[model samples]
Every structure is written in structure tokens, then in C-alpha cells.
Target: MDLINNLALGLGVAFTAQNLLYAFVGCLLGTVIGVLPGLGPLATIAMLLPVTYSLPPLAALIMLAGIYYGAQYGGSTTAILVNLPGESSSVVTALDGYQMARKGRAGPALAAAGIGSFIAGTVGTLVLAAFAVPLTAVAFKFGPAEYFSLMVLGLIGAVVLSSGSLLKAIAMIVLGLLIGTIGTDVNSGMERYSFGLPDLSDGIGFLVIAMGIFGFGDIIKNLSDKGTKRELFTKKVENLMPTRKDFKLMLPAVLRGTTLGSMLGILPGGGALLSAFAAYSVEKKIRLQPGEVPLGQGNIRGVAGPESANNAGAQTSFIPMLTLGIPANAVMALMVGAMTIHNIQPGPQVMTSNPELFWGLIASMWIGNLMLVVLNLPLVGIWIKLLTVPYRWLFPAIVMFCAIGVYSTNNNTFDIWMLGLFGIIGYGFVKLGCEPAPLLLGLILGPMMEENLRRALLLSRGEWSVIITRPLSAVLLAAALVMLVVVLLPSVKRKREEAFVED
Candidate 1:
């Protein structure tokens, strides 16, 4: 009954004309960005952050959230058509999706992706709505010690789940913590690393860092790759609807992916990309039907499974952000920054104090999923048409928009300079085979972790044992330790690397 009413309230708020229009606009724009190569949700969301400052918080977030999942929906289009992944998570989709296109089954491949996404999005949202309330209850019992331990677990998970050298991931996280410490000390009245500059007093703006790394840095990487030839598959797509047998094959994969994604997404740092990769890997090991294509050779299960998991993960990743005020990934980190800008503090209080905003965002997701499917299936031809625009022509417009957006934050040149500095660092990360997502997560969580640790120590009269003595905190810390140990083991590490195969 409570769930019914909360959903009713959410629907009421989300159905407003203004919210609906922005949701549509956001879905449309997200699909375009997703269909195009060289642009993903991180860069697009960061580029658009400044523009949301003037809008209502609910509307702003609804639109931004649409971009995240809409990109998930749109990403498979390019993967199937041109063998390109519009987003990182879609990389797994290209394996079988493009093969399906090669065999003139492009239409069915795309349909499976769309339908799988729709089902998965619905299931993920339902799980989110069901689980968020209980998680909020559990969060209320957390002391500073427990909160600090939870963040420790989150960081460990970020490092462990990341698809790269664990040493590099750890180093990147440490660097992010160092960068996070640049502001005035909250406990002390003195500035620590500001170099006596007034601009550093407030620390680096989250938007500035985001735009610099994801926006400028991404553009720099794309431009650095000289004269790349993008092969556009001009195969005509016929029969855009999946047959009954096709649906039967995909349904089981979709169900399994949805379940896996919903569970993984609630964990800190486990979201769409990880879920998608894991799902595809799992599908590869499973037994195939008598007449079905093998994995990576136009298997419809490959397209359906990863696509479903990807969408499910995208939706449910909001659990920690809304329920516990912890962002699970880079896009959610940007959401945390956006929430701060809107003066809407994320956490348990959101459910009680801002129920309308909470539920409205939830309801809008259902509507957004419908809009995405409607846009993706029937209009895929139009999206394939987007394949023709050379990335060289797109980068300039993206760069210009990023510049204007960052400047709009303070109407100053300093942030733009900071943007340039981080862009260079971001490109360096790309060159060094380092993944930047963990850094963003560490940077966002570092300050909060420090604050909680200080408060915990202060409450314990400077006793460190309180952290390990508390049951929940102790368990969380132990889990982090166990995860780290597993990742460090040579045999396990080798298998882990094989599981995350890039091709």
C-alpha cells in the first residue's frame, strides 16, 4: 500500500507538462549523443552541468538522468551498425551486434536490444523503488564510524572492479584523494594546499574537474588519434521486429541480466559497465541452443543480455546516491555535484523531506524508458544516418560548448585555465593506460570519508578501536580487506584479467 501511494505521488509529479517536455528533450538529445561516436554521458552531462543551474532541481535531474540511460539505449545502435560503442558499456555489445549486422540480421539485433532494454529498465526501476526505502532505514542506523567504513568498502570495490592494473587504479585513487585535499581544512581554520591562492579556498569546483577531464580530456584523446577511418555499415535494415523464436531466446537472457544488474547496481562502484561485461562473459560460457549462433557470431543472446544488464545497471545505480548519499560511478558523481548546486542534499532525508522530488525522479525513469524504446526501435534508420558525420566536425562544437558552460559557472577565465590543466592530465591518464573513473569516485568520496573519520574519532575520544569494535563497521572493513586480498592473488588476478577481455 505504501509503495502504491508513493508511486502514485511520483507519477503525479512526473506527469506535469514541464517535466514531461524536458524528459522528452533530454531523451532525444541523449539518443543523439549516444548514436554519435566520441561522445558519451560523462562528457555530455559535464558539458551541460552549467545550464541546469537555472532550472528547477527536479526538472534538471530528470533530464540529466534521461541522458544516462538514453545513452545506454542509443549505444547499441552504433555498436550494431558501425561496430563502434557509443559508451564504454556498449563495447561488449559490438562483439555480436556487428556480426548480426554482417549476416543481414541487423533489424532483429536492434529489436532485441531495444526490447531487452525496456524490460530491464522496468525491472531495475521496480527493484530500486522496492529496495531504496529499506536501504534508507539501514542508513539511519549508521554512525560516523560505519559511514567511514562503508566508504572504505566503496573505494576498495571501485579499485577491484575496475578493468585495469590494480596498482594503477590504486595510484589513481590516491592521486584523487590528494587532489580532494586542496581546500581549506574543515576542522582547522587554515588552508593546507591552496598555495595562498584565494580561488583554491573553496577547493576545485566539481564541474570544473568534470569538464576538464571528461569533456576536454575526451575531446583531446579523440583528436589525437589521427585520421581514423570509421566504417559505416550501409546495410538496409528490414523487419525491425523480432520473431517469436527470437523473443523466446532473448527472454531468458534478459531475465538473467536484469536480475544480475539489479543486484550489482546497488553495490558501491558496481554499475552498468561492469554488469554488462559480466553478463556478456556469463552468456559466453553457457550452453547454446541446438540451432542458435554461438557467442560472438551473431548470437541474439549476446545482444539481449548485455543490453538488458546495461540498462538495468544504469537505473539501479541511483540507489546509493539517493538512499545513502554515496555516488557509485562517475555520472553519479556529477549528480552529487548537481544536487549540491541545486541545494538538494542527497541522503535518507530525501525520502522524508523531499518525497516529491524523490518519487518524481523515479516515475520519470519509467516514462523515459518508454520514450527511449519508442525512439530507438522505429527511428533507428535516422540514428544510423547520424553515422555519416565525421567526428572531426563534431569535436569543435563539443569543445566550444564545454568552454561556454564552464565559463558560465563563474563568468571567469580561471576555471577555463583549470579545465585546460586537467584536460592535459586526463590525456596523460589515457596515454598511461589508466582509467579515470576510479579517480573521480575517490575524489568525490574523499572529503566525506575524512569528515566521517574525524567525527568518529572525536566521538570515540580519539580511540581508533571503535571503528573495528562496531559490528557493522568491522564487517565492512573486513569485506574491503577480503576484496583487496582476492585482487592481489596472482592466480585470481590472471583469471580476472581474462574475464575482462577488451575484444
Candidate 2:
């Protein structure tokens, strides 16, 4: 009864003219960014952070949340149409999605992706509403040791789910952690690795890393491959809706993806990107129907599952931030930054003290998902036409936009320099077949892990055994070890190799 009344309160607030307009605007902008390769939710949100300063806190947050999930929806459009992933989570979508496009089923693929996303988003939001209170209660019980151990488990899961060689994934994670430590030391007033550069004292911007690696890096990869030709599947999209067979095939995958994403999104380092990859891997491992295409060759399940998982993960990743005040990913970190700027502390108290704001935000997501479906389904042909645009023209424009976007954040030219540096590094990662997603996760979690580890030890008066002695912390650490062992197993390795590889 309380849940219903609270949700009713939320719906009332969300339906306000001001909030609806912003939600629509955010969804539109996010979709535009997602249609273009390299400009992901992180970059888009970073670019738009300055805009949120003047708006009401509820409107600002509702808008930002819309953008996050809207980009997830838009990313699949690019992945299926152009064989380019607009967002990292959409990377797996490109595996079979592009193949489906090539086989002249772009309409069904797009419909499946969009429909699956809508279903997943709704279910994810429901789960969030129902489980938030209980999760917050559980969160209050976690001490610093448990937090650090949970992060270890998350990092290990990243390694387990990463597509490339285990050794290389571990290396990327280490490199990310090293980069994360480049700023000032928290305990001491001294800067650790700034090399006398004052700009380094504030630390490398998440925007810089994201725009550089994904935005500039994608430009470098696209330009270097001059012979690439894109085929437009728009003409074949005469039937915008999915076939009955597609509906039958897609429902199960959507349900499974929603479940997987909801569970994983609550983890420390897991988010839409991880969820999509994990969902795709699982779909590939399942038994296929007799007449169905192979997993990597235009299988509708491949498109439906990952797309659903990604959106669900995007929605549920909000749980940690909303309930526990802990960010599960880079975007949620920015949301935390938003909350702080508004003089609102993020925690269980947020629900009590700012119920209107909290519930409104949740309610707006459902409306936003509805807006996305209405916005995207009609725009499918236009999105497919984007592939027709020449790379030579597109790449230069993207590079310019990235330069301007990075510079606009903090008005720092050094950030632009960092962009160039990471571009080369990102390109290198691509060439080496290394997934950059895990590296980003590692970078975000590294500082938090350090802070928690230090605090846990301090509370124990420097007793090292406290990490393993705490019940919850011990379980988390043990889970990390198990993940490591499983990842190293010969059979799991072979299956992973098969899962990530495309035909």
C-alpha cells in the first residue's frame, strides 16, 4: 500500500509539464549522440553537466537519467545498421546485429532491439522500486572491509567476462589502476604523480578518458581503414514491425536478459556494458532452434538479448547510487556529483527527506522509456540512413566535436592534450584485441577501493586479517578467487572464445 501511494506520488511529480519536456529533450539528445559512433552516454553526460547547474535538481536528474538509457537504445541502432557500436554496451550487438542487417532483416533486428529494451527497462525499473528499501537496509550493514572485497569481486568479474586473453585483461586493469592513481594522494597533501603539473593535481577527467579512448580512438580506427564501405538496410525496412517468429524468439531472450542485467547491475563494477556482454555470452551458450541461424550469423536472439540486458542494466545501476550512495559506474559517479552540487546527500535518507525527488526520478524513467520507443520506432529509417553518410566527412566532424566538448569541460586545454594521448592508447588497445570496458571499470573503482581498504585497516588498528575475518568481506573475497579460477579453467576459456568471436 505504501509502495503504491509512493509510486502514485512519483507519477504525479513526473507528469509535470516541466519534467516531461526535459525528459523528452534528454531522450532526443541522447539518441542523437548514440546514433553517432564514439559519443557515448559518458561523453554526452559530461558535455551536458554544465547545463544542469541552473535547473531544478529533480528536472536535472530526470533529464540525465533519460539520456543514459536513451543512449542505450540509440546505440543498438548504430550497431545493427553500420556495424559500429555507438556505445560500449552495443559492441556485442554488432556481432550478430550487423550480420542480420547484411542478411536483409534490419527491420526485425531494430524492432527486437527496441522492443526488448522497452520490456527490460520496465522490468528493471519495477525491480528497482520493489527492492530498493531492502537493498538499502543490506547496504547499511556493509563495513569498509566488505566494500573493498566487493570491489575485488567486481574487478575479477570484469576479467572473467572480458573477451580477450586473461593476461591482457589483467594488464589493462592494472594500467587503468595506475592511471587512476595519477592525481594527488588523499591522506597526504602532496601530489603523487603530477610531475609538477598543477592540472594533474585535480586528476584526469573521466570525460577526457572517455572522449579520448572512445571518441578520438574510434575516429583513428575509422580513418585508418579507408576501404570500408557501408550498405544501407533502410530499403528493406519496409516492414517496421517484427515477424511472429521474431516475437516468439525474442520474448525469452528479453526475459533472460532482464534478469541477468538486473542482478549484475547491482554489483560494484557491473553496469550496462558488462550486462550486455554477459547476456550475449549466455544467449550464445543456450540451445538453438532447428531452423535458427547460427549464434553469430544474424540470429535474432543475439540482438534481442544484449540490447535488453544493456537497457535493464542501465536502469538498475541507479539502485546503488539511489539507495546506498555508492556509484556502480562512471555515469552514476556523475549523478553523485550532481547530487552533491545540489547540496543533497545521497543515501537512505534521500528517500525520506526527498521522497518527491526520489520517486519522481524513478517514475520519469518509465515515461522516458515510453518516449524512447515512440521516438525510435518512427526514426528507424532515418537512423539507418546515417550509415549512408561518408566516413571521411563524419570522422572530421566527430573529432572537432570531441575537441570542443573536452575543452568546454573545465575550460582546460590540458584535457584536450590528454585526449590525444588516450586516442593513440585506445587505438593500440583496439589493435591488440583488448576490450577497454574493463579498464574503465578498474579506473573508476580503484580510488574507492583504496579509500575503503585504508579505512577498514585503520578501524582494525592495522590488523591485516580483518579483511578475511569479516564474514561478508570473506565471502566476497572468496567469490573473487572462485571467479579467477573459473576464468582460468580450460572449458570456460574455450566457451568464452566462441562467445565473443563473430562470423
Which digits, one per residue and each the tens of the lDDT, describe model 2 over residues 182-288? Answer: 88898887797899999999789877887778667767886777565655555646566888988889899999999999998877667898799889888978988
Question: Which candidate gets the maximum TM-score versus the true structure?
Answer: 1
Off by over 4 Å in 1: none
Candidate 2 lands at a TM-score of 0.86
Full-model lDDT for every candidate: 0.90, 0.84
Q: Among these predicted structures, which one has the highest lDDT?
A: 1
Residue pair clashes in candidate 2: none
TM-scores of all candidate predictions against the true structure: 0.98, 0.86
Q: Write the per-residue lDDT of candidate 1 for residues 367-434, one digit (tens) a residue.
A: 99999999988887799888787777888898889889988988879888998999999999999999
Clashing pairs in 1: none
